[model samples]
Target: MKSTHVLILLGLLAACKSQPKEKETEAPANAPKAEPIACYQYATAADTITLKLVNMGGTVGGALIYKLKEKDMNAGTIKGTLRGDILLADYTFKSEGTQSTRQVAFKKTGNAFIEGYGETTNVNGVEQFKNADSIVYSSSMKLEEIPCK
Candidate 1:
């Protein structure tokens, strides 16, 4: 496996095994979002997401698997993937569907971790998804001091 993948795996592990952070005292007025460091880059080791969609106020749970790549540090950037089959929920379709997203994760200052947001839309000739037809999302799952096992 590539070193980037290794780093990502370690990062996931770190997120999983770390302790909850207590509210620390406020930093100096000039403190930056992240400690300045060289750019951090990582490739997908393995990634998966579970999402719940509410159409017409009805909730449906769906899951997606992703190949996540990220460049970490303050305002980091991530480029990963989303697929149609993985994103498709239990919707009646007369025709087909398509998944569309680009470079999912991008770093923003003051955010605690790697964050990403994307959407999925399915083409259905039968009926248009009412109430909510699309998914929009983001996540801040940054872990610190990860050493891959």
Candidate 2:
């Protein structure tokens, strides 16, 4: 009886060990990867740059071009370089008599269109008093094509 009990226990242990655990599966081979609907890298021709900071408004409508690192029109975070023309679109203003330049880091999201948001001091400069500012910018940039080149 003792020997039989030992054999049964061993058999149960072996059976439990032999059973396979579930394995992780990869997505289907035909699964589609997300691609941008449209994207553009600013070249020599600078687009119309506009800003509405507090009661101040400025538009640097000139040859202000930008570079594209990895901006996906469909992605939530659209980031890259924001330099070309001037050192920066700087300013100084105040509601109660304090002034500072704007500074901001832009991120875009949406469909064929993208909306950007960041500190005024991020894009502008230190004189904008960005700590007291919360802003979102709507891109007038027309979605053309995301060049793979």
Candidate 3:
């Protein structure tokens, strides 16, 4: 009788040890969540430009569109990194049914972004700034913050 009781107790212990444990079902309280996208636009009587940006820990991606009088509309996506107030990106766009890629830079001031212009050289068909530090941010092309639509 004593042997039988000991065997039953050992079997129960083995069964409990073989059971699977439950996994964690909740995310950590400090995990990062999705960030909101921002949009901006610059418009005049004869020209308009729009930008949408998503920023995640300084990495950015977005869309840009330019519609100028007597010029083919350029629409594209931009992916790049934001350092302080400066944004350096690659603009892959289509204009007049032709696809093109170019490097673009912008300076963020207050709630607006000014497009940067500089001397460029074509490398492997992609236009790249010759001197990024010498690029000029133009106020005339500033895009003001706008509500996303």
Candidate 4:
């Protein structure tokens, strides 16, 4: 009788050990998630520029529109990566019934983003910056954060 009780207790211990804990089977309840889409606009008396950005994992994609005075309006989508406070991407736009692709860079400061310009070389029909480190961020073309509509 004593040996049977000891064997039963040992069997119960093995069964309990084999079962997975409840917390181990459950996923984390506070896992981090990606941020929501953000939109910004820069408007003046004669020009209006809009930008919308969506973050997928670590990559960034969005739409950019430029309606400048006395110039053909260019609108397109941008796909790029944000490194630190700088955003480097390629803009494929349509203007004057023609499509063009060009590299674009922007520097983020506070709630605004400044456009960057630099010398570029046309490579295989795509215009790209000769040296990204030499790009100049201009405050005159700053785009402020705006409510997305």
Candidate 5:
């Protein structure tokens, strides 16, 4: 009788040891995730400049439309990385009916993107912004953010 009681007690102890304990804190499985942000910016009526970009984790992908007075329009797709409110990208566009690629940069201020001052280079017979600085806000060049519809 004593041996049977001891065995039953040991079995209960083993079973208790094998059982999992309830966690004091647990996260829900259906938590919502963060979504990427997208924005559209355009210049005022004085200039024909438009930019649309989707920013995910400081990486920017966008399109740029530059329509200057008496000049051929530049419609381009931009792919670049953003660092601390600065976007550096390569723009591939069609200007004067020619397809070309160039480097461009923009500085974020408030809800506007100011064109960064930079030097231009001829790449494959196309002009491009090489290295840039965020020191200049050219006339009718600042892109103000508008609601993307």
Candidate 6:
């Protein structure tokens, strides 16, 4: 009788045991996808600026092309860290046949990136400007987002 009771108790305990959870092998089919990268361009009489950036959260990284007549035409890369609505990055490019680097910032409004206020970067004794504004975009020469093909 005692042996039978012990076996019954063991059987009851085993029946009440919880099963191990199964791990997820893959993401759900209905999971949302990430946003695609965006491209922007700014044109003026003196310069033309183009940027192809991918924003992950608030951080930005992409290609930047800046060209200014008699100043510099640079095709460099940008790695931006966000502060407020501004994306600040160090721009390194080949300017006037010479390589140089500088600090540049942009402010995002809607789908546009207006100049946030660039001081000056010395690139072989030359300076590059896409707009006349010392700290922000003026009435003209704004950086607007362009559709990618």
RMSD of each: 24.4, 15.1, 6.6, 8.9, 10.5, 10.2
Position 106, candidate 5: lDDT: 81
Of 5 and 6, the candidate ahead on TM-score is 5
Q: Residues 18-116, candidate 4: write the lDDT tens digits.
A: 666566754466643446567888999999999998885677888999999999899999988999999999999999899999999989989988999
lDDT of 6 at 16: 95
Clashes of each: 4, 20, 0, 0, 0, 1
Writing each residue's lDDT as its tens digit, candidate 1 over 64-117 gives 223344521122122222232122233221212443322222232331223334
Model 2 error, position 50 (Å): 16
Worst 10 residues of 4 by lDDT: 25-34
**Sliding window of 10 residues with minimal summed lDDT for model 2:** 53-62
Across 1-149, the per-residue lDDT of candidate 3 in tens digits comes to 99999999999998888667699877676754336568989999999999899875456888999998998999999988888888899999999889999999989999989999999999999999999999999768789999988
For model 6, how does the per-residue alpha-carbon lDDT over 73-115 read when each residue is reduced to its tens digit? Answer: 7799886676766677767777658776666777778888876
lDDT of 5 by residue, 6-91 (tens): 99999999888866777856546563333344554565555577788876444577788888777788898887888888788888
Which model, 3 or 6, shows the larger lDDT?
Answer: 3
User: Could you tell me which 10 consecutive residues in candidate 5 have the lowest summed lDDT?
Assistant: 31-40
Question: How would you order the candidates by TM-score, starting with the best?
Answer: 4, 3, 5, 6, 2, 1
Q: What is the lDDT of residue 73 in candidate 4?
A: 94
lDDT of each: 0.33, 0.35, 0.89, 0.89, 0.73, 0.72
TM-score of 5: 0.62
Better of 3 and 6 by TM-score: 3
Where does candidate 2 stray beyond 4 Å? 1-64, 67-104, 111-133, 142-145
TM-score, each model?
Answer: 0.19, 0.23, 0.74, 0.75, 0.62, 0.57
